[model samples]
Target: MSENNSSQDSRSRIARRVFPDGVDPDPRFTLANERTFLSWIRTALAFIGGGIAVEAFTSEIFGSGLRATLSIVLMVIGFILAAGAAVRWHRIESAMRRKTSLPLPLIIPIVSLASALGAGLLVLVFAGLL
Candidate 1:
């Protein structure tokens, strides 16, 4: 192959593939979407770590089955969120790259649950239950 032809082939490989007769979109938008997904994954990881920390540290202080169960439940939920995040991020990224609308994740339910749990914890702490 000629030098110019080989260089063109390399460039094509480096660039994102575009589907014929599909949406005309900028590659930068796809990249930005992917970055956003990664950020969400990081946030999920932080949530998981925080939950684990709370469970591990407070278990001894609470000295009660209820406290321990609550802490473990938080940690388990965090782990579930982290796993869901990875799957959701992948789906969103894939859809964005394909020039399709991203689907909504289950974050709404998770967030609501977390908020309720947080309120319960606060109530318990204030009442000297934990």
Candidate 2:
């Protein structure tokens, strides 16, 4: 009986978080939100894997330094994006439950970081550093 009560309470809390302000949010939306979060995680893993691939597979051909740096940076970006995605997903879900507008993430930072990485790689490749 106690276990059942605890489980029920947990479900209630989840439902409350997922349907705050009595907005009558659909259960399907919750499942979609979960899927989106999972997608972000997969994307992050791919980025990290790409980085490793560059170092492992291309190391013999392209050598090291510039290419290695690019790979590592990409991997770092992936990790950052993954973490950002998790936080954003939760925030969005909670805001939806509360019927509040979602917050804008750090788009400028993300863009600048990506641009810088790309430009650096381009310069290194053009200069024959890679």
Candidate 3:
């Protein structure tokens, strides 16, 4: 019926290869989702920037080997965060289109655990225990 046609129209408007079903979501909701997506991108950039700053400014505090490892770890986390944000955005958008309950954000706990471990590593390094 008309609903099916509306779904088809929505699916065809953007990347047809992605989310091939479901009606168009409210524009306000979609814009809000996009803003959240941008926020995650900013967070990812902060992680990457922090890694660069540590590598560039901590030479006096950390040996080259330790600095390199820490820098790489932070940058890798940033990359993972950016990728996860993209996937999460798509998942949320898909759910919205389908009128389904959104999925729980799995990134929060994982990022929290990672950040705690990183902070612990920093503490150990600063205490000359690492």
Candidate 4:
């Protein structure tokens, strides 16, 4: 009985967070929110994995400083993406529950700029101009 009560309480808390106006949203919308969150998580994992692989396997190709810098940058981007995803997930869920427009995703611009810079750095490194 206690376990069931606790679980119910937990769910109620989540519902309140997601639906502050006490209106339950459609189940399909909630599932879509979950899918978006999972996609972001996969993206974050890929960024982190790419960083680790570059650092571990490309030591011979890049100078120590360049390799380390690229590795750190990729890891930092991954962390940022992960944190941003969580915030976006919550905001989207809340907006969906409230029947409001979804918030614009901020990750696209950030990732694009970062990728451009990373590519530039890689070119410089490879051309021995770094």
| Candidate 3 runs further than 4 Å off | 1-14
* lDDT of predicted model 1: 0.66
Please report the TM-score between candidate 2 and the true structure: 0.67
Clashing pairs counted in every model: 0, 0, 0, 0
- Model 3 sits at a Cα RMSD from the real structure of 3.1
lDDT of 1 at 85: 65
Question: How displaced is residue 102 in candidate 1, in Å?
Answer: 1.9
Write model 4 residue lDDT over 1-130, tens digit each, in one string: 3666556654666665555553456989878888988898888888899889889999889878878888888988988989988888888878876788889999878878888998898788778898
The sequence of per-residue lDDT tens digits that candidate 2 reaches over residues 7-98 is: 65535666654544434447787688789778878877887898898788886656588567878887997888798778877777777776
Candidate 3 lDDT over residue span 7-107, tens digit each: 75644555555877677789999999999989988988988998999899999989999889888888888988899899899999999989999999987
Q: Lowest lDDT 10-mer window, candidate 1? A: 14-23
Error of 1 at 108 (Å): 3.2
Candidate 4, lDDT over the whole model: 0.81
Off by over 4 Å in 4: 1-10, 17-19
The estimated TM-scores of all candidates read 0.62, 0.67, 0.87, 0.82
Candidate lDDT scores, in order, read 0.66, 0.73, 0.86, 0.81
Q: Which 10-residue span in candidate 2 carries the lowest summed lDDT?
A: 16-25
In angstroms, how far off is 127's CA in candidate 3? 1.8
Pairs clashing within candidate 2: none
